[model samples]
Target: MDEIKFICECCGKEHESWPAITYNSPSSYSNLSDQEKEEIAVIDSDFCVIKHSDQVDRFIRCVLIQKVNDHCEDLEYGFWVSLSEQSFENYLENFDNENHETQYFGWLSNYIPQYQFTNSIPTTVVTKNGNERPEIFPHQDFDHPFVKDYYNGITKEEAEKRIKKILKN
Candidate 1:
């Protein structure tokens, strides 16, 4: 149980230390008692834990925090779950339409060999090395006929006019 500190490398700001909870721990989800489960269910939260009675079955659970893909500044305590490598791989492979998971899977592929059940969840921050930012919105809708006409030739003046119209409204 080492102390964990998060420092903003750019601004040199020290974030407040939170309770050291990891995805892999005895206190983590699935391992929680029935009472704990009820407590969590009452509050509608998810978490990672293994049933102590079933530890021999070789499975790990996780309650992934909700903002796992967003800016670290907005994260808070989240629920957990138990997952198997095969199941996790399948999840990465079978994500339906959520681009955020797709983005995470892409990022995780390079580190697949180092994947571990007990590892701390990683957080992202803007840094000097400039990692690509995640797509924050859906692809631009181009259903209008005007979009095709304007696609490659959106002039600076037109863009400014559009912005002025939007701001004025």
Candidate 2:
């Protein structure tokens, strides 16, 4: 796998090399009891924030896997990461020039492909584990055919326009 360097947005720590998965074990949630688990929903869940590069904002990924038949569509609910409010504002401020904007947004377009995307926004839900589930709102990801088409060939201006349309709703 290709490696990328980035500054940790959550910890402000600089990391060099490729991104890797850091798993937190089940013991991480061992302290929660049945009542607490009901209040939270999940058990032994872990959270991670993905920072693709120095220039790109962090993409948070928090998830857990276990066997359960519930209202959830899958065994796990995933949170797609995005820019923080302040970081998004900064991104907009630099979007006038496609070249400059692409440096940031291009990374976004490419980093998130048309797959692994959902219409849901990031939200907080108490899990059985006594932890809050990380949420992701609707947006284009590598999974969307339109978004895949857009990232594959569309220019920055065109991509921005499409993104704007999605944001309006």
Candidate 3:
């Protein structure tokens, strides 16, 4: 038997291992109104980036899915943003329609420190369009401060330092 370990880039700490990362788009995407679709930026099909408009605010939801031997599990992470229309359009223009497994990084409004071993923390979205389902991994929810540091543009080094200080006490 062997033990696996991963050095987290966000917190700069060693974790036992990371689970396979996956993303899932809500089935509601197809049902969105044409106007809604116009305001949305489809990211590799698995993610829909809704811009901040008078009708709706900007936000992102990332789903983490894991597959074990015969079972599958999942959880959701998300955040709201205030991106400008131009920025949102840029993202839409850059979207790769052919590959659905595209990875996008954004700020997180919620943080689940328990999954520190995750390949990437809250901000990483792994698109699931045009790809096979992802493998599942064991997951657990632990208690920690729900920090908005990611949204504040805190670097991984700073986050890791803060986490160490918190855990040290």
Root-mean-square deviation per candidate: 17.4, 21.5, 13.8
Worst 10 residues of 1 by lDDT: 105-114
Give the CA lDDT, 0 to 100, for residue 144 in model 3.
22
Better of 1 and 3 by lDDT: 3
TM-scores for candidates 1 onward, in order: 0.22, 0.23, 0.27
Rate residue 139 of model 3 by lDDT: 18
Q: Clash pairs of candidate 3?
A: 66-136, 67-135, 67-136, 67-137
Candidate 2 residue lDDT tens string, 1-169: 3435667565576644322222232221334466644554342233222222343233333442222222111122243334464544554454343443221121121122323534423222212223233222223444555343423444444434433443443
Cα deviation in Å at residue 146, candidate 2?
Answer: 9.8
| Model 3 agreement with the true structure over 1-169: per-residue lDDT tens digits | 1335767575677755423222233333435687766666453432345443444323334443322221122122222222235534444554555464444544332324333432322334444565432211111232222322222233434444443543454
Determine which window of 10 residues in candidate 3 has minimal summed lDDT. 67-76
Best by TM-score: 3
**For candidate 1, lDDT tens digit of each residue in 1-169?**
1335789664577754333122233234334577866654221222122334535211222222222222233222221322444543444344332442322211110011112333333322111112222222111252432323223333434433433443344
Regions of candidate 1 where Cα sits further than 4 Å from its true position = 1-6, 20-59, 68-169
TM-score of 3: 0.27
lDDT, model 2, position 153: 47
